[model samples]
Target: MYINGAWEPAESGATFAVTNPATGEKLADVPDGGRAETVRAIDAAHAAFRGWAGLTAYQRSEFLYRAWTLMLERKEHLAQTMTREQGKPIRAARNEVQYGADFLLWYAEEAKRVYGETIPAPRGDQRFIVLRQPVGVVGAVTPWNYPVSMLTRKIAPALAAGCTIVLKPAEATPMCAIEMFKVLHDAGIPKGVVNLVTANDPAPIGEEFLSNRKIRKLTFTGSTEVGKMFARGAADQMKRVSLELGGHAPFLVFDDADPVHAAKGAAMVKMLNTGQACISPNRMFVQRSVVEPFLDELVSRVTRMRAGNGMEDGVAVGPLVDDGAIEKVDRQVKDAVAKGAKLLCGGHRLMDNGLDRGTFYAPTVLADVRPDMLIYREETFGPVAPVIAFDKEEEALEMANDTHYGLASYVYTQNLARGMRIFEGLDFGIVGINDINPTAAAAPFGGSKQSGLGREGGHEGIGEYLETKLGGFSV
Candidate 1:
């Protein structure tokens, strides 16, 4: 753990092992941080907030820019470490490192653009000014799926907006967080400005974040159920919160869409983190006329997907984070098949090819998945694709919007009018017309309804870490 600009262990001398999900091997032991450690980190951030917030935006930008450069320079090491810890393919991990670095770079520039505004008052010789100021100390809880990207997404904007932060990364992937924080420290981040605490049991740490008066903002990226708990805990203080929660994203493939192209795109996105991503296409709705062709292309593409250790050559998919994830995926697939859905390809867990000890699941595709099936209602956070057919545009739209989650949705269509209509009608915060990955450092990333609250990137990202002040003056 890094707290108060120094690396330290837990006060209780306890530690937890971070395991390699692909092989179930122990990677490294991290500090088992709890309430005491969390309190120390929070205090450090709170104490450092004045000095950090006092620095000019340009000054902050310099540190961020340096960190960005360092991240790129150490890209290879970061990628390897991420692959070891998070189990994504080396290529995917490398891309994640680059994507994470972009946040630092983007925020470095954006820091200089956090401009204040002046307004004229009705009274003679009166002036009004609106200023955006840092919201003080922040508490960030990030998930494990995209550890590097999620950490950067929260901290970059917070730092750019002049707030000090105490971060608690997911227990399953703490090495990446520790490594990134080292880069930040080396890049001249002020002592105590940024702190990190690793803990397997997050409840104690989370409680401190909620009760600590000094922490003005709490940001989290995880399940909606956990997000609600944080919201309730923060209610007393009315603490500012930003949540990027769960999603059961819908992928709509219209008859006009090239079935092969659409299938290829959906497969690519769905296979990212083995479809564990919150925005991964969960329910795929295809126009009935094009269902068979789409399934053919999708199954063929998925069938070729190679799942094994991330370090292996030519591996496209990797193991689930743990045995529990594999079990959940297994249960969903079995239930779907029992409920009359046809298993097109790769339905069972993969144990051969040196994968017996690891948490691996075969890339699965199910056809004729109905509304009542468990896979249809719940998120299949694994390498599974469930295809549902619809006859009319209305039916497709209705099926897409039936879920409580409104995080991300994809529509594949050649017609501009229909695309625009679907775009307007969809309830999700993010809509991908033909694009699988719509998230970017320069755009706001968030969801509507149960998916989440507030945004993570772009100008809006920085806004979450800032407070507005209005001043009136007579001259």
Candidate 2:
């Protein structure tokens, strides 16, 4: 663990094993830190907050820029580290590394652009001004999936906004966080300004983050269930909280669009990170007239995808995170098939051909899926795409917006008017009109309803770590 700008083990000497999901190999034994460790880290961050936040934005920007350059220089090494722990394809890992590094570069520039405002007062002698200041010590928890990007997304903005932070990365992928901190430390971030804690269990660490008074803000990227718990816990302290939670995104395919092209796009997005991402389209809604053709094309592509160890060449899909994820996905597929949904292709676990050592599931596609099935309601979180046929535009739109999750929704329509209408109608934080990849360092990435609170990217990201102070000055 990296805490107080130094590498240290848990005082209790307890450690937990980190294994490669692809090979089930023991990678390393990380410190199994708990509440005591968390408190120490929190205190360290609190002690360093004032000094870190007092630095000029330009001075802070230089540190971030240096970190950004180091990240690019070590991009390949970081990508390999991510794939080894997280079970994502090497190419995808590289892309994520590049994407994650961009946050540092972006926030570096944004540090200088944290603009304040002056408003006209009713009285001539009085002036009203609003200043954006750092929110003080922050506590963050990131998930296992997209390990590289999630940390950079949270840490970059906090530091750029002049806030000190204590982060507890997902136990499954702490190596990525460790490597990232090395870059930050080498870039000359001061002691106690940033801290890291790794643990086998999250409950104890989370308790400290929630209950600690010194932590003025909390940011988390994980499930809605845990996010809700954090929200309720933080209510007592009224600590500033930002959550990027679960998503069950829907992809709409209208009859006017080319079924083949739409199928290609859907396959790519659905299979990204083996469909582990929050923005992966959960339900694919196709206009009835083009439903058959789309399914045919989609099934063909899914079958053609090669699944193996992420480090190997020509491997597009890799192992699932663990056995639990495999079971959940398999259960969903079974329930959907039992509920009368037609399984087109690839519906079982890939345990043959030396794949039995790791948790691997075949990319699956189901058609004629009804809302009564489990796959229709819950997030599949795997490479299983359920196709629901719709006749009218209103029906498709209604089905798209039916979910409580409102993170990302996709619409494919050649008609400009119809695309615009669907874009407006879908109640999601991000709408991709004829686009599968809608996220970037410069764009706001978050959800609307149960998906999450506050944005993660763009200028709004830095705002999460800042508090607004309004002053009435009289001269």
- TM value for model 2: 0.99
TM-score to true structure, per model: 0.99, 0.99
- The clash tally of candidate 1 reads 0
Per-residue accuracy of model 2 over 1-475 as CA lDDT, tens digit each: 8888899999899999999988899998888999998998988898998899999999999999999999999999999999999999999999999999999999999999999999999998999999999999999999999898899899999999999999999989999888999998999999999999999999999999988899899999999999999999999999999999999999999999999999999999999999999999999999999998999899999999999999999999999999999999999999999999999988999988788888899999999899999999998889999999999999999999999999999999999999989989999999999999999999999999999999998999999999999999998
TM-score of model 1 relative to the true fold?
0.99
Cα shift from native, residue 223, model 1 (Å): 0.6
Per-residue C-alpha lDDT of model 1 across residues 1-475, encoded as one tens digit per residue? 9999999999999999999988988989999989999998989998999999999999999999999999999999999999999999999999999999999999999999998999979999999999999999999999999989999999999999999999999999999999999999999899889999999899999999999999899999998999999999889999999999989999999999999999999899999889989999999999999998899999999999998889989899988989899899999999999989999998898989678878989999999999889899897889999999999999999999999899999999999999999999999999999999898999999999999899999999999999999999999
Task: Please list the C-alpha lDDT of all candidates, in the order they appear.
Answer: 0.93, 0.94
After superposing candidate 1, which stretches have Cα over 4 Å from the reference? none
